[model samples]
Target: MKKLLYAIAVSATIITGCGKDDEPTPTKVPVEGEITGDITANRTLAFGNYTLKGMVKIQSGVTLTIEAGSTITADKSNGEDGLVVLNGGKLIANGTSDNPIVLTEKSKVAGSWAGIIMYGDAPIVNSATAPAPQVATSEDGLSLTYGGSNAAHNGGSLKFVRIEYAGQVITTNNKEHNGFSFYSVGSGTVLENLVSYKGNDDGFEFYGGTVSGKNLISYGNSDDSFDWQDGWRGQENTNWFAYQTGIGNYGVEVETKGVNNAFWPKVTNITLKRAAGTVTEAQSEIQLDAFQFKANGNGEFSNVVIDGYINQTTPTAFTGGAVQIRDLVTYDNQVLTGKIKITNVKLNNTPTVFIT
Candidate 1:
């Protein structure tokens, strides 16, 4: 398996309401404020139950460390509540399985909030120079630039985190924020044990990044569960996708954007579970392709199990060598997988994103 375990070395300290320290970390400072400049000091946000009200930014050359067991809710009334880690900025959000961190909207509705974005300067295809090392900036209004020769660029650490009711819509098209958007991040970045549930857009989307991920879960996302574009070359492992809603799009959506065709990511031990029914016949179950690859995208899938989806039509644009699609498993003729079996763990009255 292509388990990129070396990407993140996370701490195993779980903190609920009780802390191991004598004096518990003080609470009250909400994630509500503007950061127009650099933050030189190390700040610990006591997730004492507060809501993030607007677009919070971590300026370049700054690190924001989040305390474990903290649940940061998004007040998405204005549709702009989320976190953005700009290039050269870092976010260390390390949460334990028992006391995992949660980011979701107060409304608790999909498409009601924006999500986390990590931008970095790493190597991408057609990168402005010959043999191409193309650099790119974020969408309008973000002003975040990414892509460079630094394969060791460290964006930050995110472990045992859950993002729910996310994926802000930028337009009517598929242009929107993902549950966890990794833009031009490098191999030195850390991503693991992340769950994205009921997102409006894709669950975990990568654009021009080389970061590896593990223990990912995406359920009931409106768009793709996992998506990548713009020359992403990462490795992912132990991902579980449970799409019981017909609104879900692709299990894995691959695309190569701009003038770059270097889309290759190693995916291993994937399990896409859905109800057994004819495609488009079930309103509350999966009804589309489990995997969709286009625009010269490539990936290597090993030990994959796609359950319950009756028909899988590969796009004509997707060809061989671009991706090694192997170990395919589908529905068992007439046997239904029954309802999704998920482990629900609630935190501090916060809605828990269901995990397997």
Candidate 2:
């Protein structure tokens, strides 16, 4: 009887242990070498003599870290685009000033890839009401949706980066793409010490968001030096220098035609020397228009210097209404030497007073 009781207890123990073992145990699948080709993410991707052919989409919550001196050349020979589309993803491109991250074409000449397009899910102009903002798609007559959130969006950072000879396509009827295009980027993102050299289009173009930046340099760009469109409320502290051979339309262009009427961009400590080309006979300089401000609303400016060579071709340097100017204050030698017009300005030695 004792032997049988002992055997039954052993059997019960064995059965219980077996039942526990039968329960499913979670196992971690190792994704060691999952990435196959160019379009890859969520893993460390190395570029060695590799050509980024098509649009590379970096998904959200993932970090794409580019090492120093890693030349990610965009293949512009083909109709395909070499772009890094940041769909709420993070790009930690911490390039040093000595060796900046180069985004250029296969050819040594100008006009290369479509440029770096960063799309965030932030509140753009008319984001709540208008249709979702769309980007260029590979298929004909198709576009990708991006940007829309009530809360503040955080994309990532672009620091000590340089884009050379970029921006080829005229994406829209009136506006061309820029060297560094920030589409619907939010205030959470950080951009600083950026250089756009010899780009065919604008140096830095902001579509719509509350993104503030500083220490931006644009040398020999064809289009406008700095452009703001679709209700961008950001503070900028920059040094703008243009060359005479450079075919830039305007020094600073602001066009806000969508929602958010109160478009106030505070600009301070800007040094603009236009028409610095090798040819001295031509006079290429800064030009301002109120069409953008009128379409949106008035703007505010302070401590800005517009220095340009004046000649026959150069129209009135500055043309805008005083009502377009809100709290307009000027310091450190605000002199309009050439054929210029100041509608309503309050000139003060130190503290600026209202003209009204």
Judge candidate 2 against the unseen true structure and give its global Cα lDDT, from 0 to 1.
0.51
> Looking at model 1, which ten-residue stretch has the lowest summed lDDT?
327-336
lDDT (CA) for every model shown?
0.63, 0.51
lDDT of 2 by residue, 165-247 (tens): 77666444433456777776777877877777777777788766667767677666676677776666675644333332445
**Model 1 ranges off by over 4 Å:** 1-41, 126-131, 140-143, 171-174, 236-244, 258-263, 276-287, 311-356
Q: Write model 1 residue lDDT over 185-267, tens digit each, in one string.
A: 88888888788887887888888778888788877777778888777778554554445355565567665542333235777
Q: Which residue pairs show backbone clashes in model 2? A: 243-276, 244-275, 244-276, 244-277
Model 1 TM-score relative to the real fold = 0.71
Residue-level lDDT for 338 in candidate 2:
15
Cα distance off (Å), candidate 2, residue 35: 12
Q: Single out the weakest 10-residue window by summed lDDT for candidate 2.
A: 330-339
Compared with the true structure, the alpha-carbon lDDT of candidate 1 equals: 0.63
What is the RMSD of candidate 2? 19.0
TM-score per model over all chains: 0.71, 0.66
